[model samples]
Target: MQRYFVAPEQFRGVIITITGEDAHHAARVMRMKPDDQIIVCDGVSRSVRAVVLEASPQEIRAEAEEELLQDSEPAWSITIAQGLPKADKMELVIQKGTEIGASSFVPFESERVIVQYDGKKEAKRIERWSKIAKEAAEQAHRHRIPSIQPVQSWRQMLTLIGEFDLALFCYEREGAAAHGKGIANAVRQWKLEREKSSDEVVQNPRIVLLVGPEGGFSEREAVEAEAAGAILVGLGKRILRTETAGLVGLTCLLYESGAMEGA
Candidate 1:
């Protein structure tokens, strides 16, 4: 079934009015007719199994048949605090990160970052990244769309680390432990600890994963991240590009957290 996101205000009683670009796509591009079954998710995460009742040039109306659970979301919220990379790599990060169930993205300016977003350019960049996130969410059938927050400095990123239960800093040169211990091991450990104490599941655990820029973080920056309570971990022996590292880490994290597994 085809799926699209709608605003909460568009939902009145059992009827949902899909407007804007999506309406155009349905009415013109897809050429959807009346009685066609489709899925409509509110940007906030609520979804409904709907069937088209009316289709017009500017709008498409559907009747809600059943409320759908957002099972694709991970049990824990994972936020990627990535150091801004060069060129259009941010766009790729936003798209793939959303598909892997990242709750949010924070683009940080690190000491080693070569490209910087300043003044009006930052606003424009954020706007573009937000649109990419939305489109990616729709394409991935995600109930909730992940947000691309404004760029932050390395210091500011440190301040925001405390908001999460666990903060992991991916470093290629870290000597703390071998990268062989995959993300699954970390999640299993956390889960086991929680399960031993209580039968209740810890839903919505917050995890923040940090990835450095193209040149990677300086030694001082890595030290500062650790001081901010981030655990420095290696991805593997092979060095990954700034664009590939964060998404790869996030995918493993989500899989370990049970967000990517079939229910």
Candidate 2:
């Protein structure tokens, strides 16, 4: 079934309204018509099965038939804090990362970063990324769309380290014995802790995995990140590009959390 995302307010009781580009796609691109079945989500978990009542380029209205309880989102809230890569590589990361179950993305500036965000077009860039995430989420049958955070400076990103329950940093020079625990061990430990915790756990534990730019993080930067509560993890013997490292780290977290398993 086709899926669409709308604001929370767009849903009024049994009536659901889809506007803007989504409407255009459904009405024109897909040639959907009345009585067609589709799914609509609030982009924050809530979703419903609906039968089209009206379809047009301006707007598409549907009546909710049943509420869907989809368990498509990952158990862990994984955020990829990536260093700005060159060209459109960031877009590729966001698109594929969402399909792979990343909950969010944050672009940060690092010493080895080759590309920097332009202030003038920052809003446009963010919009593009958010759209990519939304489309990816829909295509992947995800219950919620991944969020895209604005580009953060080295200092700013470091200050936000305490925000997540855990932060994993992928360092090219990182080692298991020297850097505390390897990623697999660290994630398993964290999962065990979560399972032992009481029901008072209000939300999925948030994890921010940081990956450096093309050349990776400098020794000083890695040291400072470790000091700021970020667990440094090595991605193995071979080197990966800035765009691939975060995705690999996210995959590790997802697999460790049993997110790759069937529900």
Evaluated with TM-score, which candidate comes out highest?
2
- lDDT scores for all predictions? 0.84, 0.89
Tell me the lDDT of candidate 2. Answer: 0.89
lDDT of candidate 1 over 23-77, digit per residue (tens): 8989998898999999998878589999999997699999999999877767778
Q: Which segments of candidate 1 are over 4 A away from where they belong?
A: 175-201
- Which window of ten consecutive residues has the lowest lDDT sum in model 2? 173-182
> Per-residue alpha-carbon lDDT of model 2 for 1-263, expressed as tens digits?
99999999999999999999999999999999999999999987589999999999999999999999978888789999989999999999999999999999999898988875688999999999999999999999998999999999999999988899999888877543455456788777776787788856535788999988998889899889989998888887577888888888889998987888865
RMSD of each: 2.5, 2.2
Per-model TM against the reference = 0.90, 0.93
The number of clashing residue pairs in each candidate reads 0, 0
For model 1 the TM-score comes to 0.90
